[model samples]
Target: MDIFSRPQTERSPLIDFDFANRRLRIEGESYPEDAASFFGPMFKSLEGFLADVSDETRSAPISVDLRLSYFNSSSAKALMNLFQMLEETARGGVPVEICWNYEADDETMQEFGEDFGEDMEYARFNLRVLDTDVS
Candidate 1:
């Protein structure tokens, strides 16, 4: 699953989805004018990657790392569905872990992570706050 490797866009995040290593990362902002238009292919790619993974590997785990500074309400809903799919996969015996990363001062993102974590019963969800002073 090859994902965003170009210059950042205003409407889409940097999709670094990798199936071979089972590491998917979405960073930056998400406020696409057409939420479905953006998420449609993204979700399709995810499904395809997962399918290929299921066919080849039996016990490899997937790790999702999300670091978004902002997202529209529609995008938020889309993200929820994405998490649901991941949770379902995990329940199907494939280990999955989600790391929701946000800026240290962003409470909205933290709450969003908490909500998704609460909804997931099989996948392990973690909320990570990036420190601005790390540099």
Candidate 2:
């Protein structure tokens, strides 16, 4: 099942939730008009997927990569929820990895990644700031 390609909006982040092969990614800037409203469904969908995990689950050893340049505080909360869901899934025997990628110059994003990483246990979250040409 494919849960990628979020609806285009005036202020929304791009999403790529691939259920096949156990890799999920959310990249690009995120400053949605309504953070909670936009992220609620996303959290719900992720939870639903994890709830039905069995022997034949497509998403095992899940890897979620987040490369956001800017996200409001509300979005940060929503992100925490997402991490929580993934952490729970990992604790249930399924290994999980969250890669938080940020621009090398952006210390804010690096710190944000560290914050999220500190909160997780089962999931091996990585805080990697890369030098990219976003210009």
Candidate 3:
């Protein structure tokens, strides 16, 4: 289970996908020109990681923290796909929690999280407001 850590860029976010800890944290903005290219490997790694989780450790809760300052429509769609996969994985018996962290002053981010949360009926979805001054 290799950790996937990518530094943040002007048009993307910082991705820290830790399979060993069963935790993934994606921070910063996501507005890449090619969303699929940006997220393909992440999605593939997650799928493999989910499949590799042994029965003995399946009980360990999986957590994903999404802390985004901003994202464009393409990135939003990619996010929806990621959320769907997580929700499916959770529905298949693994315990999962997804925290959508948004800046406290960003109503748009809050609404986006809520919209995404609606699709995650099985996974424990949380819309967390972080007290960040970043606009």
Best by TM-score: 3
Looking at model 2, report the run of 10 residues with the lowest lDDT sum.
Answer: 1-10
lDDT of 1 by residue, 54-84 (tens): 5457588899999888888998999999998
Give me the runs in candidate 2 sitting further than 4 Å from their true place: 7-10, 133-135
lDDT of 1: 0.83
lDDT-superior candidate, 1 or 3: 3
lDDT of 1 at 43: 88
Q: Which residue pairs show backbone clashes in model 1? A: none
Q: What tens-digit string does per-residue lDDT give for candidate 3 at 8-122?
A: 9999999999888889999999999899999998988988998887889878999999999999998888898888888988898889999999877899999998989988878
Full-model lDDT for every candidate = 0.83, 0.80, 0.90
C-alpha TM-scores of all predictions: 0.90, 0.88, 0.94
Colliding residue pairs in candidate 3: none
